[model samples]
Target: MDFSFGPEDERFRAQARAWLAAHLVGPYAGLKGRGGPGSEHEGAEDRRGWERELGADGWIGLGWDRAHGGYGNRGATLTQQVVWAEEYARAQAPGRVGHIGENLLAPTLLAYGSPAQRDRFLPPIARGEELWCQGYSEPEAGSDLAGIRTAATLDAGDSGYRITGQKIWTSLAHEADWCFVLARTEAGSRRHHGLSFLLVPMDQPGRIEVRPIRQLSGTSEFNEVFFDGAAARAEHVVGGAGGGWQVAMGLLALERGVSTLVQQIGFASELGEVVRVALRTGAADEPTVRDRLVRQWAELQSMRWNALRTLGAQSGTGGQGRPGGADPGAASVAKLLWGGWHQRLGELAMQVRGAPAAVGPYDWSADRPYELDALQRLFLFTRADTIYGGSDEIQRTIIAERVLGLPKGARPST
Candidate 1:
């Protein structure tokens, strides 16, 4: 892949950088570098408003086609999207509140949704007026999605389906306006069969409830969502009933799209801070610590190039013209690469801090029993990096069975 950006791409980068500088002001200025992974609970309403500010400038759906209410005509190339992500991170802008909707659901809808569904759902998301949370994992179905037991029955009036089940580890569920749920719609259907992807409104009175789960970092960005006969309109179903497996898989592929690149940029920032800490604390004087830091820098660069290569291949396939959709191997490899790297980076972060890492927040009041610094939060939160999303084991299995055509592993009885 060509590493050089054309003149037009450079101009786009300049425009993106300028816009971020101009708009990240006042209340938004303090938001820079806030609201990431473990710190998602910080200034959420402020971040939501920033999301709308981005939408107002037509910066929300950079990769979606114009026909789908995006900026495709003005050359929303993969390169340009990458440029925007880089600039966004460079500015230390607030983490996006609508990312789950903009990156995952909108693309999947474009690929598998009915015209009416797209017409109804795409506009609000494009304008950043709504936020979305994923409802794929349940108590029994974290990595093994086929084991999900969330069930939905068709309503008596046939206008929609009534969903009843529990979803755990639901990120941003407390703040989302909608949730895309995968529920079993066929009685007695097992595994991946009988599933439907239903878009559910989150504000239902007696039907939906969200309870935040406190993490080790003392934040409640993750939640447990209960659906007691929650209703999804008949037209709100994506990819038809009993056909949600494919649509859900497509959305998983999109989960590894351009956003991964943006995540790496954030990781780069975090790593830079670690390096500064190491230097300030004389950890860099240690040969092993210095070597590990150098290796991390090199590996991050390699990951960036690999992402560009994979996204370029996807674009060439005329698919959604984004990353990971065309190549499942690329998606799995990317996950495996970053998951372990992040976990290791977290370890390195603690190591560089030495004994200071072991201490908790100074405020131990009853109201604030526990608190964590940024590095402490990164260390604690990234321990789940290898577990959430898809897990290291699942990624390796995908590469082994799906990509390499290896024999299937034996399944344990539930």
Candidate 2:
């Protein structure tokens, strides 16, 4: 596949950059999160507001059709989206607040959800009116997802099931209006067979409880959700009964393929921020820090290439499943490489900051909060990069068996 963006893509980039220059101004110009550079900065509302603006302008769902509340620009190819990712990477756009909606749920709905389901969910999500969070990782089922104990039994006579189970490590549940969950409906089937995907409301219910989980950065980035006989709609069912595995796999494809792109770009931007700090503080003069920064930059580029390849595949340009497409092995490789890159970058950033990296928020000037807080938070979060998206060991095993065509190991005893 052609890696270079032709004249068409270059024009798209120009238009996007120009529009961003005009609209992303004043308070909304800065990055999100703790220790950001500016005191007058954008908040979640600002991010949502910008999303609404993108939606209104048809820039929000850059890849989706116009009828589905997107900008309906068919001119932009998957390459153009990659270009958009690049430009946004340069501008330091907010790392998607409704990632579940935009990346995982939206695409899944487009592919699997009914027209009514699409009509109800897509527009609100595109408009930033409804936020979504994933409800996949349960207490007993992280990597071994088929072991999910969450039950969504059919009710006597109704629109939905009586869902009762606990989902842990649910990201952004605090702000989400809906959750795409995986629950078991069949009792006799093996790990991957008896599951179904459910779209659940967070507020209404049998009993909805959300408890925030603190990260190493001392921030509550994820939550634990407890559901007790939550009423869901039959329409919310993504795939047929005992098909949750397929639906969940598709969602994971979105997770590892599309959603991962947004995050990897965001992380790459953070790596760039490290360079900016190095330049600002004269840390680049240090050979160690300079070499580390250079390596991180190279890794970021490699990841971008991989992401482009995935997008190209999605656009039907290449192999059956792009590297990081639906294949678990491919996703595992992407996750492993991405996690390593992020962790190394964080370490390098802290090293560049030296003693100041450990200093609390109070030690830094308010103007430099972006660097300070990012360094702190990134340092904390990077530790889990290997664990959250599936452990590094699992990734290696996938690569060995699937990618390398190695002999399969004996199945682990449950």
Candidate 3:
């Protein structure tokens, strides 16, 4: 597939760049390069404002099909979408706060939701008026998603269901306005058979509670959420009740396309910082350190190529979030490639610093939180890189069974 952009794409890139340059100023000036994977605690309120700024200018949902109500704004061609992703990253714009709603939930709704369901949920996401968090991972079913025990019973009058269970490792739950949850809807059902995907509001004080889970980096971007009979309107179910497993899997596959470009850009910046540290500390002289850095550089380039290929395939197949579509191995392979690569980069970050990487500048005697350096945060946070968003083992299992057509591995009895 051709990877080059033409004159029209370049014009779109200029338009995206000019708009971001004009708006990412004034009160939003300080937001540049703030809030991402390791630094999610920084400037969250400002980032929310920035999200609204994006919506106001019709920049929130550029890839959604116009036939499907153009939820956020006008639809752009795949090339234009990629161009916008490139410019947004190159501008060093603040990490987006609306990505979960815009990228994950909105796409799923379009693919599987009824027109009524789409009409109700898509507009708020497009306008940056709502924030969403995923609720697939539970205390016992992080990787084995089918084992989720969270139950939602049909409430009185059959108007909705009442959800009662706990969800852990929920990213940005504290700031989310809603959560798309997977729960057991069938009383006697086990595993994936009886699960339902429910859209739940976060404002019920007595019913829903969010408690932040402090990380080693001293940030609480991940949270432990509790639901005590939280109400979910019957109409809010996506992909219909008792069929959530398919909907949940579809959302995971939506990770293809321009989102991959955004990730590669972030990886590139992090690598640049590590190289700068190596040069300043004279660690670049070490053959071993130099070898690892070269490997990182090469692997990053290869991943970008793979991402472009995947994007091309998705574009040919009518864009992302189309259920039961795209190469099954694509998402798993990307996950494996980046997860381990990021973990290794985090290790290299400390190795370049030598003995000083372990120590912090803050005095232990102080009662306040310690301010850790960038490298420190990266190292601590990446320890879970291989664990979250489907572990390395899980990805490999998927590729082996689904793509290679090998004998399926043993799964626990439901």
lDDT of 1 by residue, 1-414 (tens): 785788989999999999999999998999989999999988999999998998888888888877554433243888899999999999999989999999899888888887788778777887889999999999889999888999999988888999999999999999999999999999998888899999999999889999999887778989999999999998898989898898898888878778999999999999999999999999999999999999999999999999888777776744454335566788889988998888889999999989998987665466665568889999999989998998889889999998899999986453
lDDT of 3 by residue, 1-414 (tens): 887899988988889999999988998999888887889888999999988888888898898888676674867877788789888878889888889999888888988888898888888888888999999898888988988999999987889999999999999898889999999999989878999999999999999999999898888889999999999999999988898999998888885557877888888999999999999999999999999999999999999999888877776646644743668899989988999899999999999999999887766688655588888998999999999999889989989999999998788776
Off by over 4 Å in 3: 363-369
Q: Which candidate ranks first by lDDT, i.e. highest?
A: 1
**Which 10 consecutive residues of model 2 have the lowest summed lDDT?**
33-42
For 1-414, candidate 2 gives per-residue lDDT tens digits of 788889989999998888777777776676433222111123756776666766666565566645443423343567677777677766766656666787778777766777788878887876767888898888878876767888888877756787889999887787788998898876665678788888889987448899987666656667899998887887788876777877777667667654566667677667778888889888999897788888888888888778766666565622122223444465676788888988887788888787888876543556553433657767777888778867787779878987889998876443
Candidates 2 and 3: which is better by TM-score? Answer: 3
Query: In model 1, where do residues sit more than 4 Å from their true spots?
Result: 67-75, 317-325, 364-370, 412-414
User: All candidates' lDDT scores?
Assistant: 0.88, 0.72, 0.88
Model 1 residue pairs with clashes:
none
Q: TM-scores of all models?
A: 0.96, 0.87, 0.96
- How much is the lDDT of residue 62 in candidate 1? 84
lDDT-best of 2 and 3: 3
Model 3: lowest-lDDT 10 consecutive positions: 317-326
